[model samples]
Target chain A: MTHKIDIKNLNLYYDEFHALKSVNMVVGEKNIIALIGPSGCGKSTLLRTINRMNDLIEGVRITGEVFLDGNNIYDPGMDLYELRKRVGMVFQRPNPFAKSVSENVAFGLRVAQFKNKKKIAEIVERSLRAAGLWDELKDKLNRPALDLPLYQQQRLCIARLLAVEPEVILMDEPCSALDPIATMKIEEMMVELKRNYNIIIVTHNMQQAARVSDLCGYMLLGEMIEFNKTSEIFTNPRDKRTQDYITGRFG
Target chain B: MMKLFSEKSIKKALTVIAFSAIAALLLIVVFIILEGLPFIFKVGISDFLFSSEWEPQMGRFGIFPMIIGSLVVTLGSMIVGIPLALSGAIFLSEFVPRWAMRIIKPTIELLAGIPSVVYGFIGVMVLAPLIRDYLGGPGLSILAASIILGIMILPTILSISIDSLKAVPQSYREGAFALGATHWQTIHMAVLPAAKSGIIAGIILGLGRAIGETMAVIMVTGNAVILPKSPLYSVRTLTANIALEMGYATGMHRQSLFATGVILLIIIMVLNYTATIAIRRRVGKK
Candidate 1:
């Protein structure tokens, strides 16, 4: 399997407190990988480190490297903006810009300085279709994205990232605020999306991980306890901590 | 039962206190209208508003010059102040470290604590001379007043704008940056648009301050009651006209000054309403 992202012996610190300790994992291309753990287990922190999203926080320090494709993203000469473009993130809550649906999708293209109006419109439609939002949102393209229902808004956010044509999509609890139906819809979209792009999701729902992820990693206290095929991780966890977590004993 | 009675009495007292503030404002509005409107009718509305002549002793009380002066000076101050205040707000909110911003913001706010006379004093002693030596015409001109007023309104605009910018959710910035937007691009495209209504409200409030200011304007504007030909020409604002004349005027002349006060009140009310409408529209859209 071709490794799309290689996280090598990564350690992260927020001031004096170590947030992620000696974590390492390789994510395969065009597949869904889920990271499951309780809050403060550093699953989100690990995910953020992949795109240097943690760099925005003050007093954050990192050692070791995250390699995207073949390039070390932590190199001194790496362009932060370019790295983020190639690895986009969807936040926990749906955070659509206070703009029209079409404009939200077109934002990334505009940031890349794509100025042709016709080309932007084409890309916006394609991105929305890819995120499975075109049929419901086609006539409402000019309406404000914030005015949409929460599920549609979340889909709009996904379309926004798709517009930039990223290689990897990181979701940080993308459905925590959503109802079960909405969560299921996003999970369905994720399974479809992994056919084209690598998806790494941090989810609290163990069933969600089982349902959508091809591979799964269980984390405990900034440590990746076990990583294997989703069925093996769920049905026959290797580590005691992973077994305890999957069985609802403790996290 | 005794505790309940006291609680009811306390609520009544607080309600009376709040309504007293409203009652005071209503009294002032009533007084200004009563004293000003009769004089405006006596002089004839067209002559009072449009005629340029203003020899109050000779019973020619046209206030066209001061009206124009107030409008021009207020507009000029906005032009000078908006860009500086906006950039300062962005820098403080986005780029500055927390430690540095805490110190710098309070220091800038100290500019507001300084008295208006002191601001006028600096304009007279420093700015006016620079303008006179470099640009020609008298040191006290409309340009000088505009610059001074712009500086005076800076703290108001800066304080409000920084708050507006800071109020934008951090999620928007994260979303923009995750899309490969540079810091400037993120601020300009995402953060700024969300804060537009608030920034505009700050600007209009600053404009209200510029127009209603009396003492500092009187000290720097040369108090000339003429139709100014240019920014460099000496002029008198409505606030300046009222303050400069109210000390020693009889009957109709005093009423004319009150009429000028009425006009100033109207301009300020229009500005406040515009701010209300702007904020209301933003809420309605959401």
Candidate 2:
């Protein structure tokens, strides 16, 4: 019932290039909100703004308010480390560390100074299971993470994030690097994950958005063209552009 | 009429050119072993390797002191060099801006071109005297040799490490940041481990240079043939032994210097072999 994240008039720029313009959206609690757009439409930009991951780029400028848990994340007093802990991200490519499978899952805990070896092992097991990779990976926990197949590597990246217990998960083209079967597995995992955590995903596949998300937003050229319930947006979109986009007329 | 060059002929020519370097290495190994092995056998490998005496007239030619000298100096160089090189590489690759690195990287590389003899001269004039006055040993001691050699090998370590650190993909950094890890934590946990193999390779290469170097080490290490008791004590490395005595030596004594070269050669091969195995173990993992 609560809006877990609230963005109002969010504007972002990299040097002189305006990357996101007036992006306003309410991300409801425990729901998977999907952003669908053509490439370079700023869907990924909007997702990065939530976790402040875009701050790493030099010459990036932002003039907006992003409220997370009712606190403005852009406020000067905000701790970046704490904010990032609450908002985890999965990249377009799976980037598991060049470490063993168990170590990859336990890295976040180790950084947080969680010293109990038994607890770390237990949590590693739970996180991998949550990512739906436990059945395939349970016996090979000590094997190098890089040796895993691409799908398992991606799942390991998810388990890495999950181990830190983030409240919001941001995924940018998470399944683009994957084939259909692995994509389906991840899509199902995301839907299951929404029972506990707020999820925001930026994706290119319209079918994926229509299938997995409860709420969907269509964006074009750094602007949000439409936002509605997934069923309503697909069947009875009020915007001519949204209709055109869904019906394969234009981006 | 123009004639076409066949791919097979070009490939064959290039293979021969590529293999010539290895063939030359084989020739050198053959020559050194032919000259030195006889003397080594007569002296007994253990006596040549483990005994400390080195008197040519009295028929004693033990090289144990030189072996210890080389080891101690190389160890000292590593002690001083590895930390500085690693930190410099990390700073260059991670902390410095692109524009700054453009200037700094080339400048760090330029440090490698200074000749060894010039380094030796500088060490004699400055570093040796500094150590002699401050650290309480004769100016020419193992410590002086270590300091100069450490600086000499810094560029090799720095450049290789920088390349390896830079090879780590940007995605790893993003993944670590997303986990709420701080900048230092991301670098320490993610970047360092990913770049470990490269860093160790650089260290091994530097260690090789430290062991093989002769001029600068001899000038500063006082060239004493005693078994060194401490860093403050004077010593003579294997390379220094051959370089200093090869011109005056004859018969078994001359062959003993070549025998020293054989030992140096074996040591390098062992170091390189270990490096290859270590790197293979870390290939895709890093």
Candidate 3:
């Protein structure tokens, strides 16, 4: 299978604190890959590195490579705008823009320079439907996005990402802020979304990693301890650390 | 044992204190009116508001020219000061690093602390001559007063605007960036819109400072009791008129200076009320 993203010896630092330590991973095309680890294990940091969202933070320095498709995204000549357009991100918290629900969905497409009113409306409807949010929100398109319930807001954020038509979607604990029902809905949406796009998700729920992801990568202390198919990783694993973590021996 | 004290007595005492503070402010307004009413009645309200001629020695006390001068100079200051202050605020809040913000924010605060007299002296020695040479005429014109006032209130606008910009939540910026908007685009569309009312309040506060300023303006405004035809024209503002004439005048003339004070107070009150309304409206919208 062709890889959608490849990380080679990627290291990240926030000033003196080493966050991600020489992390190497690959995400296959049109498949769901989940990074599971303890808190502060650098799962979110690694996820942000794919879209270069960490570039917004001051005193952050990254070494080595994160490639989207065949191109090194860290290259000096790479266009950040174009790179960001192709690789969309959803944060742990649902952060819908302080705009109307429809506008929030249409924001990414607008940024990509789609100015035609009709085209934007169609994309907004399609994206919302794809994220399974259209049935509830179709009537309240003009209401502020903040007015929606927390679960709907999370799905709206997903719709926002989908609207831009990105090839790779990086979700950093997308369901962490959600209740079990909302979490299940997002997990289901992820499985459905994978038919059209590659997905990399960092999640704390081991069973969720097993249920939703095609491949599971277990990380610890800023290092990837195991990478294998979800079934094998759960049923049989190579690393003792991965086995210990998966079996709930110790984080 | 503490609950033995009657709640009514405590409530009455607190109410008295609060009412006393408000009463004190109202007393100043009353005093201004009392002092100025004699002159205003003698000069006639229409003549004071509309007449151009102002001669204390000949007993002609028309305030139209001074009022016009104040409006012109304040408007000029708003034009020069608002954009610079807003941009300074944006730079401090969004662009500058934490270490740089530490240095720059205090420097702007220090600018606010400098005495108005020092600003007056600076305007007289430096800006007056520069204006005279560049724009011609006695140099100490409405333009000179405006430029000085602009510099004086810049710190007020910058500090307030920076605070407003900083008050915007980080989620707004994150949301915009997640949508693939550039930093500048995020700031322009989200951060700036979020902080618009606060920025407007800052501008209004700057205008209040510009309007009420006396010493710095008097030093550079040529002290001419004439309607300002242009920025280059030497003219006297209402505040300057009161300050310049108060020391020597007695009776009605002195009272008229106090009347000018009342007018100045009214204008400031209006500006402050507008700012309050703007802030409330923004809050309501959110």
Candidate 4:
């Protein structure tokens, strides 16, 4: 499989505390990869580093390389704007902008300076359909995004990411705030999305990782303990620490 | 068996206290209206609203110029004060570190506590002459009044705008940044829109302060009885007119000043009502 993202010896720190320590992993193209860890284990921090979201925080220091499409993202001359345009992110909780549903999906395209109104409208509809929310929300494009139900809002956020046409989608516990049914819908959506875009999701739910991801990485104390196919990692793991964590021996 | 009081009694007492406070405010309005009603009825409504001549000794009581002066001064203050206050608020809320916030927040609060009279004295002794020299006026005009009023209302606008901007959830900003928005872009698109109603409320409150302000404006505004012809022209605002001439005037003259008070009250009431409606609509949309 061709690698879409390659992280080599990446380390991240917030002030004095080391958050991600020398993490190395490669995510294949158009595949779903899940990072499973307990709270404070740096799963979210690792996910954020892929898109440079941690740049907003003060006293954050990063070391090593994150290559997107064979180019080092940490290169001093790399434009963050263009990099982020190619790599989109969805948050844990639904965070639709204080705008209409159509406007929410159109936000990134508008920011990227796409002036063709017809093209924007077509993309909005296509993105909504891709996220499997078009049938329910087709008639209410003018409604505020926040007025939607939690599950629908999450899907709308997904549609918004899709509108940007990013190669990779990073999700930080995207279904953590959702109910079981909503989580199931999102899991189904992820399987469908894998045909077109590479996805890296950090989740606390071991079963979710088992169900939705083709590859699973088990992390603890800011270190990657094991990375393998999800079936092998769950059924025939090599590392004892990975086994203990997968079986819920200790978080 | 141990309970001596019912829930109904506590509810009743709370309702009565709340209504009483509201009723007390209404009574003050009614008293002002009743005391000023005789002159309003005698002079008719159109003259009181549109006439510019306000000679109390000769029984001429036109309040149009003072009304125009109040409008111009209040608008000037808002134009100057809102942007300064908003920028100060954004810096305080978004850029200032936690340790620095402890020092800066209180300094702003200290501005709010400074007496209006001290602000008046500053305008009279310092700012008026500066404007006179630089802007080429009589050291006291609508421009001077606006400058003084703007300074007086700065702390109010800044503190409230900061609170409103802080009240916006961090999730919105994170969402914008995660979508690749720069700091200023995130603030402009997400943070400012979310905090729009609160910032407008702060501006409206500052406007109320400007419209009703007396001592500071009276000290610097030349207090001429004519409407301001320009930024450098002298004028007397509604509040200043009342404050300046209310003493020693007898009968209908005193009543006419009270009528001016009624007119000022009505203007502020309209402004407050519009602001309240706008804020409610924004909150509802959110």
- Write candidate 2's Cα lDDT for A1-251 as tens digits: 44689999999998999988898998877888999988999999999999999988889999989999789999999999999989999999999998899999999998888999999999999999999989999999999899998988998999999999999999999999999999999999998899988889999999999999999999988889888899998999989989998888876
Worst 10 residues of 3 chain B by lDDT: B1-10
Predict model 1's lDDT versus the native. Answer: 0.92
Model 1, B13-69: lDDT tens per residue? 999999999999999999999999999999999999999999999999999999999
lDDT of 3 by residue, A132-189 (tens): 9899989999988877888999999999989999899889898889999999999999
RMSD (CA, Å), each prediction:
1.4, 1.5, 3.4, 2.1
Could you say which candidate leads in DockQ? Answer: 1
After superposition, the stretches of candidate 2 with alpha carbons farther than 4 Å from their true spots are B1-9
Cα lDDT of model 4 by residue, A61-155, tens digit: 99999999888999998888777878889999999988889988988887677899999999999999999999999999999898999999999
Q: Which residue pairs show collisions in model 3?
A: none
Looking at candidate 3, what is the lDDT of residue B190? 71
Clashes of each: 0, 0, 0, 0
> Per-residue alpha-carbon lDDT of model 3 for B1-286, expressed as tens digits?
5665667779889999999999998998888888877777778889877888777777777888888999999998888888889888898899888889989999998998899999989988999899889879898987888888888889999999998899888877877786779888788877887788888988898999999998888888898887666788899899988888888988767777887887788899999999999888667655
**In order, what DockQ does each candidate have?**
0.76, 0.76, 0.40, 0.58
Ranking by DockQ: 1, 2, 4, 3
Interface C-alpha root-mean-square deviation, candidates in order? 1.1, 1.5, 2.1, 1.8
C-alpha-based local distance difference test score of model 3: 0.87
Cα lDDT of model 1 by residue, A128-175, tens digit: 999999999999999988899989999899999999999999999999
Q: What is the CA-based DockQ of model 4?
A: 0.58
**Stretch of 10 with least lDDT, candidate 1 chain A:** A1-10
